[model samples]
Target: MRARLMIRYILGEMIPTFFMGVIVFILILLTFQALRLTDYILIHGVKVISVVEMMGFLSTSFLPILFPMSLLFAVVLTYGRLSADAEIVAFRSIGLGMPSIIAPALILSILIGILSLQTSFHIAPWGNRQFELLVTKLGSEKPATIVKEATFSEGFFDRVVYANKVNSKTGALEHVFVYDESTPDNPVTVIAREGRIIQEKTDLGNAASLRLSDGSIHRTSQGRHTKIDFSTYDVSLLDPAEQQFRSKTPPSLTIEELKARMKTKGLKKDERLSLEI
Candidate 1:
């Protein structure tokens, strides 16, 4: 009965401290992420609800690291307090051996280890993938967030865009200029009086549509010059970041996926190393 009571008492002390430590450590790790997410709201004009969802995904990613650190902190603090109060001495004096006193902490550590293993293998990877997908969706859905006014922006694939003024509320661009090198042999240049960004869902994925009014297309190829004037024109806007994100396997693949990838033939040294890591 005394042994059971001792075990229960030790657990009662450790469980609350463990949870508190997890909260404190997770907050510490998430501070920088929160600041970055704040930029998405303030600068990129992302919705608060989306930012909150991003934070939730990020918190799950932090759990694998935070769990072990928090467990260690809880153990050290709880035991240090008990030792300072001479509880350890009193327990030893009451015929409890060192192993008996340490058993409860050991059991708690094992439980935490099991939880941390599951988080590292499964939960964290899923969270990371979700975060990446969300960011990509945001970038594709709101192309204005990627393009800044009065600057040459090259984030769009195979194209450089410049806008003298951008209307945040309506996503309208004034005095828009685009240099398109999507065709290597013949390059095209477009200048427009007014333009707006539109998003469309296609079979492949979400695509950005840059609609221009009162624009002219200029092309030069094989020592020949061609110019065409138009009332309206549409240019496809593809962000390179989104393309790259789609092409590469996310760094946080589950352990099973990593193992399968490692078994593939003709793997590059760097890719194999990354998978192993």
Candidate 2:
């Protein structure tokens, strides 16, 4: 009798969380699948492994999307079902009012809110960081995740570099090919035995620059073509670092961080709420 009542109470409290967790988890998994493929559509493209890594990155990226949704769903389903089933009416007939039936639900909500706060502040942030690390490591490894296989792997900013074989180690790009598409009538194409991409912090932000050694370029000007050999050459291109940081997508912050930010935004005048038990 007493034990059964306790079980019913606990069930009433958990109904919302169960529904919310199932729905939220499925939706989040789907979103991660979609975000991971973003790189595949980009010009140079991304590798599948890298894209998978990005999915790992995105799970935390969706913090602002998931937690609240779960909480909201839970509250609505639990309360709506209770009302529809006339459980509230029965409780009220037993000398309990709306407030009494709602008391347990409210307590459950408070517990979820605290859990959500912790997730927002800590768990979400940690996931975001891991996601970033995965993206960074992947991008660095396969700088050109995809490039039509034989096409010139022109990085961002139209700066092109190519390789028959990427040594991968030592950042050396082999069987190198490069084309200056920005050139007006006379596009310069270069081929190198070995090359390297150097990343430097520029005035704008982080960008990739090229450092080619043992390279030769065929120059065409007004239909006249000349081939030149070079021991070394260096050119700067766009690195996503500055712009990429914005896209890296970090996780939700902790409660303390939120408090600090909200303070700047403006605090509420009404700092308290009334509750009935």
Candidate 3:
């Protein structure tokens, strides 16, 4: 009964410290992420709520790194304070062993380590995949949300957009120039007198469509330029959400799926190496 009470006393001293350590470590790690995420929101024009949601997902992903460190700090700090007060000396004078005094901390560490393993092996990858999906959903917005007037906007559907005037409400644009590099070998530059950006919702996700009026498309290939005029033309932008189902990359896959993949015939050397490591 006395040993159990002593263990409880030690645990009471350590658990609060463990939680505090976790909060401090998480805040320190998240500070750098907060700065980068803030920049992403400002540059991409993403909503604050959406950014907050992403941060929540990121916090979950960081647990595997935080847990063990927090437990260690809690154990070290609690024992150090107890030692400073001569608690260890008093316990030793009474014939209690060093291991007896430290047993509570060891048990707590073991429990925390088990939980941390679950976070590392199971939860982290799932959170990462969700984070990626959120990014994809945010990127599928209309060019009007992304483009600043009279400035070159690159990375939209792997094309560059420059518009003299923009109507954010209607997604309308004027004097628009778009350079399409989707086909690296055959590049195309389009100039439009007027254009509008449209977002279509499909079963997959949002898709960006550029509707240009009174435009001329200049295609270049093999040192030759072919120009064509059109009254109206529509072009599709890169949809990040569309790539979600193409393949289950290793990072997005669970342990079960990886084990199943290992059983597949003719697994490449790289695949075998990745699974092994």
**What's the CA RMSD for each of the models?**
6.3, 11.9, 5.6
* Arranged by lDDT, best first: 1, 3, 2
The positional error of residue 117 in candidate 2, measured at the CA in angstroms, is 1.7
TM-scores for every predicted model: 0.72, 0.51, 0.68
**For candidate 3, lDDT tens digit of each residue in 193-255?**
999998887776678788999989999899998999999999876454666764455766677
What lDDT would each prediction earn against the true structure? 0.83, 0.60, 0.82
List of clashing residue pairs for candidate 2:
57-131, 121-253, 121-254, 207-239, 208-239
Clashes of 1: 0
The ten-residue window of minimal lDDT in model 3 covers: 238-247
lDDT by residue for model 2 over 1-277, one digit each (tens)?
4334633684666665755674677566767567436645463256667666666556565654566676667667777877798876776676665555555656666776786776666777667767655544445434544323345654434446556766443456666778886655678888877777765555654555668789788988887999999999876554555444442222334556545544554333332111000
lDDT score of residue 213 within candidate 1: 97
Model 3 segments more than 4 A misplaced: 142-198, 209-246, 265-267, 271-277
Top lDDT prediction, candidate number = 1
Clashing pairs in 3: none
